[model samples]
Target: MTTPLATSSSVFLQGLALSLGLIVAIGAQNAFVLRQGLRREHVGSVVLFCAMADALLISAGVLGMAQALGERPSLARFLALAGAAFLLLYGWQALWRARHSNQLEASAGGNGISRRSALAQAAAFTLLNPHVYLDTVLLVGSIGAQQAAALRGWFVAGASAASLCWFVALGFGARWLAPWFARPRAWQVLDGLIGVTMLVLSALLLRHALTGL
Candidate 1:
């Protein structure tokens, strides 16, 4: 018979692995976190905020919120549409920066934004993206809820750990890439890529929402 400890370990590892797989992709949230990290502005708070948000969402999922969401199609559609609009606006802003910014230095220009602005942007990036809900609440939560009651907490802990570690690494490790972003053209390229990515994601979300309707 499988021991309780062993089973709990298995569940924890599964949660960790699954969460990492889902969030390792370069999406709007990750891109925003990476940018903050590169700028080295309020990195600690941003990372903490993201990690806490993920933890709360994952916990909600494990508590059966996923089922409630699944039964509410209208709510889901609204979220997708709203998220798409947010992404569209942010993408345009990124493209504008790419077009107008010339002398982009690693420790310069971008730092002018206040801490409140940084946190606000972080909040928007985290909350406005529907994919975050799909991944953390729906996918992860559903999976976690399926676990035995005794193991559910362990699973959530594992998933939360993954989020915390990933954000910490991404937010703090971004400085290493400071050298590459030092050049004006490099900033332009990075901004352009972020813009294209956001736009593509927004378009996809919008299409999904419309088709489902």
Candidate 2:
């Protein structure tokens, strides 16, 4: 009774919902993106890089690369430790920012970092995290592969759309709170929240690494 168009739409929605659920979690990458957004510095490049990373990873997963990745447990373990270290460092930076909220401005010392630096940092945030590979490539990719061949593309399209929408919204929409964040106290509060998020995520990742889970 369902038209092909309707069926495709349903699959796309499923993909969008699933991808959003996975990405909406509070983690180092999202926290970095949020800070960039709030700073209004190179937000466009940051969002685009993250979305593209997810798209590439999801495509790899659909192409059966997740199986190859899954065979490398040692690689995952090594990356987990690296990721935990990076997250702890980022958390420390956030706490320092909170302590010196007077330095929190839209531009980095009124000049901001160059686009190249922003892009590099965004790429690191996207690629250096092992969980990103597991969630975007393996989990989302496996789910997308389960769809009928005709629907697989639609499913990916949906998931990609969700990622694009979320990053764009989070990056751009952050400015809407600029008035409130103009106050040093507000910036301190925001940094405090980011610091807590990074530390919590680091702890969770460290546990997962130790448990090999």
Candidate 3:
């Protein structure tokens, strides 16, 4: 028989590992967060928003709130289309920047963009992506609900904690690589990779939307 303490610890570890695995990938969201971190512009707000968003979504999943969303197949389809369009546009912009900019410069506070704009963009990147809903809400929620009733809350907490720690590290720790990214070639490579990632993600979204995959 599993002790309560052992069960809780196991569930917490499961949540942490699952969340970290889901998030620590090269996607549009992470790419945007990294760029903001490199720019040193509103990194705190961006990181906070992303982390909070994840926590909120994870909580919703744990509470079985995604059931409503699951019932709305049309909503998922619409989001997939919108997300694909946005990804395509963003991918094109990244490619354009790669071709034109000599290097990706840090956006200092002098860049004139408001913190509101940064937060809004980060929000869009987080909430507008349908895959985020599918992963965090459907998959994670279903898995959490399958666990013992007493263990679900701890699992959610562990996942939420992982989200917070990962975003903070990604946002604040980005500056360490600033020196390497200061080169024109580095910018080109980075932007090229971003472009490719965006396009691939876009294609996947489109495919899923059309094929109901």
Question: Could you tally the backbone clashes for each prediction?
Answer: 0, 0, 0
Clashing pairs in 2: none
What are the TM-scores, per candidate, against the unseen true structure?
A: 0.62, 0.61, 0.62
Q: What ranges in model 2 sit over 4 Å off?
A: 1-3, 65-111, 177-213
User: How big is the positional error of residue 19 in model 1, measured in Å on the Cα after superposition?
Assistant: 0.8
* Superposed Cα deviation of residue 103, candidate 1 (Å): 22
Candidate-wise lDDT, in order: 0.75, 0.71, 0.73
Show model 1 residue runs off by greater than 4 Å.
Answer: 1-3, 65-111, 177-213
Cα lDDT for residue 95, candidate 3: 78
**Quick one: ranking by lDDT, best first?**
1, 3, 2
lDDT of 2 by residue, 1-213 (tens): 334998899888867766765675446677667678878888888999999989878877765733543667675566556656666776777778788745323432344788899898888888988988877776666556555667877888888898999889768887674455457777677667666766765675578678875
Tens digits of per-residue lDDT for model 3, 44-156? 99999999999999989867733543676676566666656766786787777678645434443345458999898999999999988976876566546545567888889
- For each of the candidates, the C-alpha root-mean-square deviation to the true structure, in angstroms, is 9.3, 9.3, 8.9
lDDT per residue as tens, model 1, 1-213? 344888889888767866665565446677778778877788999999999999999998778743554667786677667756876886787788788655423333453577898889889998998988987887667556555567888999999998999899878987775454456677687667767766775686678778889
